[model samples]
Target: MTAGFALSPTALGDGFRIESFTEVGSTNQVALERAGQGDPGKIWLVTGHQTGGRGRRGRPWDGRPGNLAATLLLRPKVELATAASLGFVAALGLRDALQAVMPSRSVSIVPDGGDLRGGGRFALKWPNDVLADGAKVSGILLETAQGGRDGLAVAIGIGVNVVDHPRDTPYPATDLSAMGAGCSASDLFFALSDAFVDNLRLWQDGRGMSAVRDKWLQGATGLGSQIAVDLGGRIVRGVFETIDSDCHLVVRGQDGEETRIAAGDVHFGAVASARNFKAEAR
Candidate 1:
């Protein structure tokens, strides 16, 4: 195992600290435990290897040796609804970090636009996943619990495939190394921490969601195209519309009827076609 990540004096700025472990069960679980113990907000629990990592819907999330497994423990003064939006915030930050670390010779799959400066290979999937070259490269999971001192604490867990990605996933998966942009977990974590702080400031504690929404849409994939969202009990398929004011995904059917999905696993294009327009947490 690699040595624990070393901290730079200002890696995460004032009031923020990073605690790294060579191995752990789950960063989110450890971070939440810290929050429950009255540890002040702004802590990052990171592990290079996770034995009990989990993804959305309780699926196992693999953290390969060179991948990242980190959770940001936050005690933001916001309601549960507002705090939930942090998942998007985490995606944006991950994209920004990926862009920052992109190799100079890399050719992005997506076209550059708006505030995005690097090759457009990275795009945000609905809910909380990042794709590179049309394959999943990263995922985010947000969990919250009653915090000590602070009323509520959120653990924003993120995992990125740096050296290896699973081949048995529902949607395709890729790693940065395989894409020729190999980077150390420590290096990526530092960039992610810094990028997250900047994005958080722009979020203004979730009050600036409109800005976040606009930025997120710019890097969004499949807008104006077809998509299928699986909401566990039922599945909805339609033209990918937009994320609404409340961050709900809006999809328009062939009949022009609109459906606002609060939570679901979204798939589009070939991935949707292959899965028969359904997702089962892969």
Candidate 2:
């Protein structure tokens, strides 16, 4: 455990263990290396400061001091696709954790079709981003490798801004403290670990993905609104429809066509329009 921020075992619940560090290159990298060395699953690698963290699409994730950077190692008996759904599980868990720590009055529960622009409302962005007041507060990444006793190991990496966040980014970012949530890195981790356990039980190795999808949609951002998905080489502008059973993003294009995006960067509101214009210019 790191100095001044120790994890509470009671709050972590059962079937989960944690390895804490004051600093690490990346919690995901460390977890993967431990898995390769035959470490059993259900253990979390956490750090108050991470030096070489990463986000989706190989983007650099800056783990500023006093923020939370953690990864959970799991050895599931399911296939790769099924295991990939853990990202959704992680996102939901993060939402629950944020809600748990923040003051009840600080959180506004937004309905499925309700306005998300209201401040202090925590919502999930497609694939794996948690938004607070339309600004990103956390990100989740899942990495897999052939190891562990079950021959498959998954490292679910999660980063939450507790005291500070990077200002210059593609999307607006904020931290819990800035939102008036009085909590520390350790406080958030305890809530998150317990939330992940509950969500994992609900996930049930993807057999219960439908249930997870339904709950995730309740607090999803930009649903039923115009958005653009950046697919690396191209951008697709369409209505932000619901996600399919496989958890793939379902977008209804302006041409009356529906496109299922397996993986892409999603943009909303003015950002979506800007991305579409840039793509058209190219």
State each candidate's clash count.
Answer: 2, 0
Alpha carbon lDDT at 140, candidate 1: 93
Residue-wise C-alpha lDDT for candidate 1, range 1-282, written one tens digit per residue: 645575445554456888899889999999889888887779888877877899998989988776889899999899999999999999999999888887333333421121222325787878888878767888899999986456899999999998788898656788888888857788788788888887888899888999999999987877876677778857788888899987899999989999998899776655444554443433
- At residue 51, candidate 1 shows an lDDT of 78
| Model 2 worst lDDT run, 10 consecutive residues | 110-119
Estimate TM-scores for all models: 0.90, 0.90
**How far is 250's C-alpha from truth in model 1 (Å)?**
0.6
- Model 2 TM-score is 0.90
- The number of clashing residue pairs in model 1 is 2
In model 1, the runs with Cα more than 4 Å from the true position are 7-11, 103-119, 271-282
- Where does candidate 1 clash, by residue pair? 109-121, 110-120
